[model samples]
Target: MTSLPADDIASPTSTWDLVPATVLSTTETDGPDRPEPRPACEDVRPVIAGHRLIGACADGPRAAQLMFVSDAEGRLARAAEDGSVEPGCTLEELAGDLARSTGRQLHPENPGLRRVLLVRLDAPELPLLAALSGTGFTAVSRHGWSVVVFDGELDYWAVRTGLDETAVVLSSDGATRSFEVLLAGEDPADVTELDSADAVCVLEWGPPWQPAGGLPAGSGRTPAGQFEQDLVRLCAGGTSELQIESVASVFDLDPAETNRLRNYVGGGSTDLVLESVLQLVGLPVLAAKIAEGRREMADLEDARHYEPTAMGPALLRGMTTEPTGDGLMARYQRAVLRRPELLLALAGTEAALGLGLAGAARRGGSGARVLGTLSAALLADAAAESAYWATVRRARRGSARAVPAGLLRRFFGLPEG
Candidate 1:
């Protein structure tokens, strides 16, 4: 970590060292009368030292321009532009002229400027210049230009450089505060100060790879493996607070990857499972109804002199009624319990012959699918129970008639009249 004085940060200035030897004059044009000499467009040499130019443009008065240049592999790069250069000249010369014209000086203590202006020369530089505005040193555009303003005072030399999507943060003062610059838009003065600890944590999570020929696969530690191990260890037997914070720490993972990890841990087939069930099944509402019913039953059971004559029918009636516009699962359960005899009749039928109570209760699917299946099963069970009771009624009439064929037909899916 390194600390830079707040005043040390300044915008970049152009160095004219790389200006082409031959200058093209666009103002003067060849004509038949005067026979104006054809202007030579000399090839501009690349800036060799300070930074490499990634882009340029020539538009607007005096041909505004933008350029991108960088230093280290991951270190932020500087973006320089031709803010106010003399007309009709090479970018290199224009950069130098702008720096000299503005009378800006680089601090002796900060020697980050290497006196090379990366020129991305283009015609009509206004489009490029317009794009560069407000793009801080690390501001990168999809067009491949990165804008950087190194010093607030000498903003004239702020450059637009090309970049490779890499960012570097330099820190000092035990990492309490540092500067962050992007390689794509590297400007010496465009550094942003950040807390040291937080920056280090970010660096730790950056892409990791083995040094060339350093070790065989699995022979040495890897960041991904380490991260997974840490996650599992923290989640195992850890308090909710610890687990939550640990999860939050990795929030920077790409959204798609985060969802994949969450689905793996939440015991669901798909990422949509938990939310879907909560919304569709209404489990909380059903549980509340069950609680209420249990309380009601407890009161009735506590009365030792309870009479089935009056109370049983009333209880049965209460159970059979449709859910009164209440929550789905709760109403469903109440309706089923109202007709216990129906369940017993269905339990004797082939549908439930081999299924245990748990298996009989199991309902698959979600939302409408689950509701439809459960409703159908309940209807069949009730029909079976009604048929059984009807047979008993016929026997009590003393006629001992054959089971009502129509009842069997209706309940068993036989042909109907």
Candidate 2:
């Protein structure tokens, strides 16, 4: 019966931080030396985030669509649509598909990933061990949970989903309560039973875990004393909201109950954009975080170089070829914006590597063998960094936000002064 106060609630994350705002046309309009968005000699991995599914956001979705992923272990994200898992199906791909499933023309103002129904098993098993006393621990039954992600804002739905809340009980008298339980979803038996006052707020039997992500599989899960018996059913779903809830609850209460703790960490309001993006805060910490990412990447590369195993080469190839996740090429591309200076260093490094390989190429034996083998992949790492650097250099020379502007200039290209 009560609605959330209109002005008090804001979204938890903002896309504007990662997405670069479109800039006005620059010197490229007239100059003959206009640089290509990518390098001319495309031999290496390009230093840019190559989106796999472009215009996906530009395309609109139906009023709503449903995506069902399994929670089976080792094969956690099996797509239920065809009962088979796509070996390399990524989260972004899933999001994109769900966004386009209805196949409708999108409104120009509201294009891309409005909402999608995510159905999966829950993630409460791991943290449920803390229950002080409960008689039906072994009697819990499996229940499928579903939720819709609207514009990637997690907290908006958090208050309404009851299943995600946690409780502390002196006995069985207590239960974790959600801020509100507006609807209980559609069930025919209950339709005839509801009173006039109850009918206004009740729609369908809104399963407890929708906006909060799916619920954990209970007693009906794998039996005790078996190999898979001990495993807790997890719903680390593909959507941003599900992933955010699951990841944030690593050390605390049942992943379901971790909301209040998260709110505390976010200072009563958790917004990824406010904390990580906007220039209102000091970013010495942000700078360190970007540096840490670079360091971790360096460490992985070092491990691959010295591991002396056949797997190292395969791992390196995966890193370079995979465009998303922790891929090496992805890191290189992201570094282009976060640390453009690294692009200059990488250009020199690649230049030397090309020279070393040049002599090897002329040998025409082992050199040819290398080229015929993994040379394209090998050169891609170099090309990615070098090519991106070229654009940054061109922009700097043209006085594109080259002067003291804002802290963001350190991380992105700004407009002309």
Candidate 3:
């Protein structure tokens, strides 16, 4: 394995020489006409050279910056506002402008003014790929979220030989570390447990075909296979640690429980907060209770020793509307044991669920849709919480898991819903 300095990492395909670029801020700029610079919206799909730059930034110094044009409305908007379609600040021009303005060569304090990022959410838009990559903003994981370069510094663990390759990206305090493992030609099917460390891991198929997105084709997956795939993608590609931590904050989970849930979700557990809440409500016990009636419900609740709350009941009811993983409700009881707050967080479960659902909706909608339907199930759970547990109480033998996954679609919301 070779350690490479971020600045020294070469772009394998980009031929254009690195040039200076201007850095601008919407917030600091004095005029009302200024468009505030945000982390260049995560939409760019980069090629090899651009991908390398993104990886370098993620693994580079926390302060290392990449800049970009903050405009999203395109040349029409630019022309309309500035009376010209030509760029206000080209990359080279921006670099020089930034240097002169900040008086620190490039105003090391601000990174976005330097370039752009590779952050496509769906399939790659081949046409916009190069232009986006060329800007040099931070490259995103396959999931289309901004990859934050950590503050501390980076270390390399690249492997030259063939192995069941995996890349784990860890982030803390605006710092990130990546671990690239070569499994020495190990069977791709073989399970490779990630180190228990807290960092997010981005698994790469490595060597054979490093997908530009870093997520290999995951066609048909076994339960374990799916778990592994989810684990890697959730951590490496989708959502950042801070994003998940923010969701946890809505639940008022303590530092430890919040971290555990964040890492679990980062490791690819979907609907984690919701599912954990269901366990708190004793949804799975509905199946057994059907056979023994009220006696079993009492016994089961006693053993678990927890009072039902709005969260658990709501999640249970909402999930009952569709239920392939209904059996997994039993799994939550175990999780509560590991992290008691899994249930305790339910004290404010309704508020937490609402926040999570709203967060999902805020993520945006599909091409034709107006609302973000991706997380509609969470919304359904929130709306149906009042009725979910009552239905569970009336369930009979084998009835708990009876609902099909399809039923949940009614709540999935707009676009596809």
TM-score of 2: 0.22
lDDT of 1 by residue, 113-151 (tens): 111111221111212232333221211111221122132
Candidate 3 lDDT, 55-131, residue by residue in tens: 11121122332322122221100111212222233334333543454432333233321111111111111112212
Candidates in order: C-alpha RMSD to true structure: 30.2, 27.1, 27.4
* Shift of residue 351 alpha carbon in model 1, Å: 68
TM-score of 3: 0.20
Instruction: Quote the lDDT for 12 in model 1.
Output: 34
Error of 3 at 196 (Å): 27
lDDT ranking, high to low: 1, 3, 2
A best-first ranking of the candidates according to their TM-score comes to 2, 3, 1
The numbered model that scores best in TM-score is 2
**Per-residue lDDT of candidate 2, residues 22-78 (tens digit):** 111112224577542321112110111121110001000111111222121111122
User: Given candidate 2, what's the lDDT at residue 24?
Assistant: 14
The TM-score values for the models, in the order shown, are: 0.14, 0.22, 0.20
